[model samples]
Target chain A: MVLVALLTGGLFLPQWAMFIVTIAFAKALVALGLMILLRAGLISFGQALYYCLGAYAAGALGRFLGIADIFVQMLAGAAAAGIAAFILGFLLAKYRGIFFGLLSLALSMILYGLLVKNETLGSTDGFNILPSTLFGTRPGPAWVRYAVLASAAVVSLGLALVVHRYLRTPLGRLAPAIKDNEIRVEYMGASARYAVHVIYVVAAVLAGVGGALAATTVGHIDPDMAFWTTSGEFIFITILAGTGSVVAPFAGALIYEIIHTTAYDLSPNTWQLSLGAALLIIIVFLPQGLWSLVSKMSTRYARHP
Target chain B: MRKVLVALAVAAAMPAAHAQSVKIGVVTFLSGPAAAPFGVPAKNSAEFVVEQLNNGQAPAPYSKKGFGGAPLEIVLLDEAGSTTTQVTEFRNLVQRQNVDLIIGYVSSGNCLAIAPVAEELKKLTNFFDCGTPRIFEDASYEYVFRTSPTATMDSVGAALYVKDAKPGVKSIAGLNQNYAWGQDSWGDFEATMKVLVPSLDVKTSQMPKLFAGQYNAEISALLSAKPDVIHSSFWDGDLEAFILQAGPRGLMKQSLTILTTGETAMHKLGKQIPDGTVLGARGPFGPYAPNNQYNKWFHGGFVAKYKDEPNYASYQMAQAFLGVKAAWEKAQDANGGKRPSNEQVAAALKGSTFEGPGGTVKMSIGKGHQAVMETAYGVTKLQGGKLTVTNVKRYPAEKVNPPEGVKSADWIKGGFKAQ
Candidate 1:
């Protein structure tokens, strides 16, 4: 029902509204990946590495190779990120806690350093990519944004459903158990490192997809995508969204975008303060995040009525 | 009863007829590293110009109330985020705020990202600052216009100044920020120097990251090279910090340092900048601004209101507003004294020459979407505790900027042939 509403919202909503929703959904994909890590008691502070890789892959394709198909660009983004994640997962899965986070951050910054120095890709200023086309045809100027929005809605919902099913599987249920006691999970005849590696790659692939979509929607990419602060924003959204359900990240991302946009519009200079205050309020009042509110209300009404 | 009803109708109709206001979205860095040096001054200039324009207090040619008799309404937005955030904000400015026109961008990255969106939206947009030449050279736009000269002029003008001031200069080194603007500026200056002075040798070039405050290692490297000249395109806090750090080390005293965007730091860090340092304000701005009635009006009002001389950023902002006003009034006049559409205003602005606070700005490049103006560079001299520029050399717009259909780099590579 929510998916239908969002897809329909593309038709009637103003350009700005559609843009905000599209970006929110794209970032939500990254947060959704972060949700899996948070549930497993892992924090990867450098998810932006995959995000940047994905965006650059898509961007480079459009810029260098002249491939404008949205699906092809996204596939390239996902494939590139997935490969990088698969290789890096070996080293990353051996660690947990802050070590894992810091290592990820270092890796992302390494990419940032390399990108900032590469002059052909326009260096720090980056470069613009051609707008995406649907298969072989370009959408009308008025409908182009709607096309991107529709793509985001369909892809996000499809991935969310898949992740929801994954959460129901035995392997998926092992995340909380692994978080509680890794040794115990190893004693149960499953390799904790193996599960971690799989999950890490999955998370990276999701972030990659999100980055590509964002780049396509924004029509520009830069090394800032891999900066530590960008990764911090994903973590912020993940915590705010909670690991309650597959859909919670989307809800949280949408709410965060709305709050950020409204606050920025209201006070350009002090918007950061307002955003900090909102985060503080959320952390203080809703420890389990905004998702907990929905779950709490649902349970309370069921029990009392 | 009939007379009273007619009077009431006329009163209501009068308000309806005169209530029109042109909403313009003004974006700048309200909170960030760029806010203080470039963004705030531009914002201040916008506010000052709008207030004056609204009251018809501006000098001749811009004395019309507001834009073509329509009061100006500005919706300000911050330009502190990544390109994606800037693009989203640009859309919001047009679609959500319903701004009739848009102006402001201090970062070349933000400007490049916003240009296509402005074209896509068909909104009359003006870029007050942001010095990259790619915006016009890479693509063409009807609705997007840049009111300030590109960074090429600054580099070329600096090169000309160096050639004229230090004829026998030998080796050169660079300490530029590692970005497109810095890289492009250094490249142009080096290319121009090669064309003008064939014997100049390159010693070493250092590129620290943007906003990288500490330059100890880079400064040491530059000092060791002991080149005859050093060129840097540092701006904002980085520029101030470089002067502070390099002055005590005698780097500036040893080498004839050329800061392409150095005029901004002159007022605040005058004592720190060593004499003989060559500086440019990207164009004829700040100390190099011409002595014209419009400039006097703008400079006087800016100093009176802010209690400080307006920098190049402020001048550029005023130039953008004046350009808009000129175009709007021209379109209105052409439209038989009625409110003009954005297309009409854009048409009037294309290939038009107008007076800026700095001097005459010609929309002669980027197919008339980009501006070209005369640029000046000078040697800084601290005389009696007051920092003043001396031996200023002015380079005409045609002499410095690439002609309409040529890219800046390519044009420089081809020996800067006259069009």
Candidate 2:
């Protein structure tokens, strides 16, 4: 209900705010994918591989194939990323800890190296995509922006809600159990690697969808989309939001954008100072993340009242 | 009675001083690797230009008060994020901030992202320093304009300078940071060299990753090739780091090097820039910019404020801001001294010509929507313990730039011509 209300209300807000919210949610979707790993006590540092693939797939379809249909382009991106992840996840799921993280990072860097080398893909300049359409009719900038916003909101909320339900299932509940004791999970007659592989593919799809939506919103894609720093940012948001609740990543992403941008805007000279200070405070006071503070506040209010 | 009538007439002749201030949004890298050499100087120049214009403190033609007698309001935003973030910030500046004119974007990718959006929004945008020809080559837009030479001009200018000055330079090598700017620059130089210096053979090329800040292997490769010339388009800290590393290895002694944006970093790089290295400030910028009272005032004021020499990016920023001011003034003139609408300003700018710190900018190129400007570059030598570009040669805008509506690559292949 709250998500629906906010989506509807976002229409009347300023265009820039809508833009921020739309992009924030797109990034949150990616962070939510990272949260899956966070819950499983695994962190894949190269999620940008899927993210960049999705963006490039959507961008190429729109730019070269003239497929301006938003759903078709975005789904194409997710499908492409899903297939790639499915093949790679088998090998990826076999590893754990820093080795797994480094392998993912290597995969992303390989993509980056290829994109940077391909002059036809704009080399470093990147290519721009045409405006997306609703159904069959091409829309103006205002309409396109709103369409992107609506899609961002609906998809993000839908994913969060669906993932929320998934958490109650035994397979979902086994994630943390696998993290806590993989040997125990194996003794129970289920392969933890299979469970991890499934989650990996799901996370890949989510990141693909996120990157596609981001490409749609930005109307541009480049090799930097796969850069390690971009993947690092997703990991940072994952830690900041924690895996406590499905709603947490969205909230964390929104706060992260606000803080990161505020620091940049307020003090360009010492912008790092402000962001570093905020992250330090959050890590020190609420190790689990802002979600823990919110839960604690809610429980305290319930007790007092 | 005569005195009172004269005062009233004078007041009526000028537009009301109370006209609404035109809001200008300036976006550049406020915090990032690109900031130090390109973004910081450009933003600082924007600040100085806006300040001088707002206060009627600027020198001639630009002396017009605050873009047609309206006090200028300026907003500076950081273009320090993904291409998506820059696009969003552009929308924010235009839609939410309500800026009439946006002058920004040093990154070629960032500029390309915002170009079509500006046309979609119907907001006037001026690109000061982005060197990608694709902005106009890939598509045409009525609202977007780049007021400086593109990569074609910069690369071709260096090649021409070498051909004219060092005719015997047969084998040329390249060491560019791997990115859009580097690839385009190197590609254009090779294409131009194919025509201008037919005997020129590229011995080796190296593309170190951007901001890699390490170039031992690449420098060694170039040195081993023993090319007569080395061409590069690296700028900012990357260029500084490359030169600092490559200089000690005797790369300069073996090869005649051209730094496309070398002059911009001369203030800091100073004496370390070995004598006789060719330098291209992207245009006739730095100490060797245009010679005029306006140039003197700008250079002097920049140094007085920032305590450093104005660079190519700085000149480009001042030129872009001045172009906007000139367009508004022309539009206002056509309006019989009234504030011109955005369309009127765009129309006036389309076919207009304006004097800048770097000679003249002809906005009549690419069908009056894009600009073509003459660029000057030369070999560097130390003068009184400061890095200076000498033997400077200026390439006419028509000589280096593809004619309006010509694809640069196609133009080069067809023969470098103005026709």
Candidate 3:
């Protein structure tokens, strides 16, 4: 029902609202990936690496190969990010805590540095990707936002459902076990490192799809996509969403977008202060994040009525 | 029945009354590293300009009421975020806020991203301060207009100044930020210098990331190169920070430095910038602004409000608003003194000439969608505890800017023909 509502939102929402929702959904994919890592007691501060790679992949595909199809661009983005993650996971899987976080941050910054120096891709002022095409055809200008929004809804919903089902499996349930005690998981004959590597790849693929969608929706990509602050924002959303359910990331992302847009509009000079205050309030009052509030409300209603 | 009829009549009359004002969405960096030097001044100028235009207090030729009799309504937004965030905010301004026109954007990246989106929305958008030439050279848009000369003018004029002022200069080195604006500026300056002085020795070029305030390594490299001239296009906090860091180390004294966007830092870091350092305002702006009635009005108004002198950023912002007003009034005139459509306003803005605080701005390039203006460069000198430019040289728009249909790099490489 929630997915249906989001899918149909394009039919009635204003263009600005639709744009906000589209970007929120795209970013929610990244935050969703972060949630998986958070569940496994690992935090990758360089999620923006895959995010930026995906965006650049989509942008390069249109710029170089002339493939304007959104699906093809998204697939290329996912594949590129997945492959990179699979390779880096070997070294990253061995680390834990701040070491893992700092290493991830270093990796993303490396990409940022390279992209900033690579003048061919427009240096820091990265190039714009052409307006996306649905399959082989182009949507008219008026309908383009709607098309992108619909695409984001469908892709995010499908991925969210798959992730939800995956989380129910024994392998997926091993995340908390690894987080609690890697030694115990190893004693049970399960390779914790292998699970970490697989989860990292999955998370990277999700972030890649998000980045591609964002590039197509925003119609531009830049090295800042891989900047530490971009990754920081993803982590912020993950913390705000919590590890309660698959749907929390989307809600958290949507609310974050709304707060950001409204705060900026209301107080352009002190919007960052507003965002900081919001985060502080959330951390203090809802330690388990916004999803806890939703679950609490349902339980209260059941007990009372 | 009588009360219902009266209510319906009042409702019908509300829109006509509300149409008396024109809403303009103004985007600038009100926060972030750019705010203190560039964005806040532009925002203040917009506020002041809107107030003056509404009251018809501006100089002659711009004495008409706001937008040809409709009061100017400003919806200000902050331009502090990534390109994607900017794109989203732009849509909000146009579609949600329902602004009639949009003005502002200081970052070349934001301008480049927003140009296509503006065209896609078919909204009249004027770029006030971004200096990228690629906006027009890369793509064309009927609805998009930039009322400032590209970075080409700043770099080319700096090169001309170097040749004229420092005639015996042998070698040149550069320390530009690693970005499109810095890269393009250095490229133009180098190409122009090469064309003017064929035997000029080119030394090492250092490119640090934008806002990489620490410049010890870059400064050491530049000092080792020992070039006769060192060119930089640093602006805002980075520009001031460079002066502060490089001055104590005697780097400025070691080489003749040319700062393309130096006017913005002169007042703020007057004591830090050494004498004989060459400065350009991106165009005939700030200290180099022409002493005309338009300038007198703008400068006087800005100083009175801000309690300080207007800089290049302030000048550019006021210039953009003036250009929009001129085009708007012209369109209204053509429409029999009635509110004109965005298409009509865009038509009037195309290839139009307007008097600004910086003197004359001609929308003469990018098929009349881009602006061209003369640029000036000068050496800094301390006077009465304030920094002022001496040995000022003004380069005509034709001399500095590339001819129509020619890219800036290509024009410089082709020996700057048709000047």
Backbone N/Cα/C clashes per model = 0, 0, 0
Order the candidates by lDDT, highest first: 3, 1, 2
TM-score of each: 0.97, 0.94, 0.96
Q: Candidate 3 on A1-305: residue-level lDDT in tens? A: 87788777578988889889999988999999999999999999999999999999999999998887888888988999999999999999999889999999999999999998888898877888898999799999888888889888988999999999989898899999999999999999999999999889999999999999999989889999999999999999989988799999999999999988888778777888998898889989999999999899999999999
> What does candidate 2's lDDT look like per residue over A1-305, in tens digits?
87779777987977777777877887888899889877787889999999999999999898778887777777977898899999999999998889889999999999999999999999888999888776778877666677778877877888888888877888888889988999999999989999899888888988998888888877888998899999998998888887778888899988888787677556656667888898889888888888888888899999999
Best model per TM-score:
1
C-alpha DockQ of every model: 0.77, 0.59, 0.67
Please report how far candidate 2 places residue B76 from its true position, in Å.
1.6
Pairs that collide, model 2: none
Worst 10 residues of 3 chain A by lDDT: A2-11
**lDDT of every predicted structure (CA atoms):** 0.91, 0.85, 0.91
Candidate 1 residues A99-199, lDDT tens each? 99999999999999999888888877888879779888999889899999998898899999988998888888888888999999999999989888888
Candidate 1 chain A: 10-residue stretch with minimal lDDT: A1-10
lDDT of 3 by residue, B213-296 (tens): 899999999988899999999987788888888998889899999999888888888888899999988899899999999999
lDDT of 3: 0.91
lDDT of 1 at B27: 95
How would you encode candidate 2's per-residue C-alpha lDDT over B39-92 as one tens digit per residue?
889989988888889889887877877998788877888888788767876877
